[model samples]
Target: MLSRISKKNLLVAAGVFVVGSLIGVGLFTFVYAKGISYLGNDPATCANCHVMEGHYDAWLAGSHANVATCNDCHAPHDNIVSKYYVKADNGFWHGLKFTTGQYPENIEIRDSNRAVTNEACLYCHSEFTSDMRMTAGSDQISCTRCHSDVGHRKR
Candidate 1:
């Protein structure tokens, strides 16, 4: 019902609108996630999501308050690259889960994350755990197994 030129123009306009909308959404999400701040090692960034409020509150009152930050325990601290990579991987998965409403009301660490945390625990408490490690023999022991609520006290 219209000339070829008019139809072409309409298609181009629609394409532009779609592209623009996607860009806008991307920019908004980046800002909302506090993307810039996430690049740093600040523990406060973890509290940005409402779901983390209770954990953050408990952490503040927990024994680790003066000694450790969120990243120190939850992320790799061996090197800068590994640290940021883990953070990026975690941030991506977290964003996906949260956006899709697929996350559990009571958040849990994945097994991979648990390994990281265990490594961190050992890294920090190697001196104190020397006897435990020797006594455990072939059996594996995770610090969190006995002290699950140490870092973030139960609410």
Candidate 2:
């Protein structure tokens, strides 16, 4: 009976240690990666990674620099839930890629993110695009398809 209790105690201790270690490592990585900064609308947060330096610099010099932010153009604005969902999803993938150094040399927006951006463009430029949107029928129009350089012009 005593040996059984000792084995159970040992198992509990090991479980506690494992869970604690995981939490500790997660906290450390969060702080080291400036994970909290990604929650805000700051464009500088996007530049935390070295790969985004050029993109951040281009945004600073772009026409929308004073008017919009990285989130405004990139994240969903349909609702709070969708916005945070996209942010969290993107954050996880970006963190994984950046940490593993497995990202592409030229980072291109994914199709889903591109859809979000197109919606954002339409949201902001609704007045001008209202007619076009109505006449386009079933075809989807992408703002970036024509004005790709508008947000991140080459330096």
Candidate 3:
């Protein structure tokens, strides 16, 4: 059997190695994913993953390119906290889906995300849609019902 001191030293060494390895992996992942870019409002940051490339490209060529951006339509615009929360939430889900290779070939918006997008549309086009929305039985109208691919047309 090893001496007590030797066993203690071995345990310490193993602990140190495990901690160092974890830190190294975390650092590498952050750098590889351009983690810093995701903290900003830049639309291109969304394209960090290959899965988002088509959406990014479509937005670039879409009519809203000059007027809006990915975050504007995809994230909550109410405040900084809400915006980043949506970003982080979306990033986590997207990462999980992409990493697991479980995402559908044709990506579809979740109802929750669609709600955010609808809110964004109403925010920007309230002037044009207010009268219509206020009309009888118009509360059920959804901006995306007819404008589903307005921001990013699927290839």
After superposition, the stretches of candidate 3 with alpha carbons farther than 4 Å from their true spots are: 134-139
Model 2 per-residue lDDT at 53: 94
Report the C-alpha lDDT of model 1 over 58-141, residue by residue, as the tens digit.
999999989999998988868989888889999999888987999988898898898889888888897987666532767577
lDDT of 3: 0.87
- Poorest 10 consecutive residues of model 3 by lDDT? 132-141
Instruction: Provide C-alpha RMSD values for all models, in order.
Output: 2.8, 1.9, 2.5
lDDT (CA) per prediction: 0.87, 0.91, 0.87
lDDT top scorer = 2
Model 2 scores worst on lDDT over the 10 consecutive residues at: 130-139
> Residue 137 CA error for candidate 2 (Å)?
7.7
lDDT of 3 by residue, 35-105 (tens): 89998879999888898899899999998999998888988878989988888898899888987999998
Residue 57, model 2: Cα distance from true site in angstroms: 0.3
Error of 2 at 67 (Å): 0.4
RMSD after Cα superposition, model 2: 1.9
Which structure among the candidates has the greatest TM-score?
A: 2
Q: Candidate 1, TM-score vs. the true structure?
A: 0.81
lDDT value for model 2: 0.91
Listed in order, each prediction's TM-score against the native is: 0.81, 0.94, 0.86
Instruction: Give every collision pair in model 3.
Output: none
Model 2 ranges off by over 4 Å:
134-137
Off by over 4 Å in 1: 1-20, 134-139
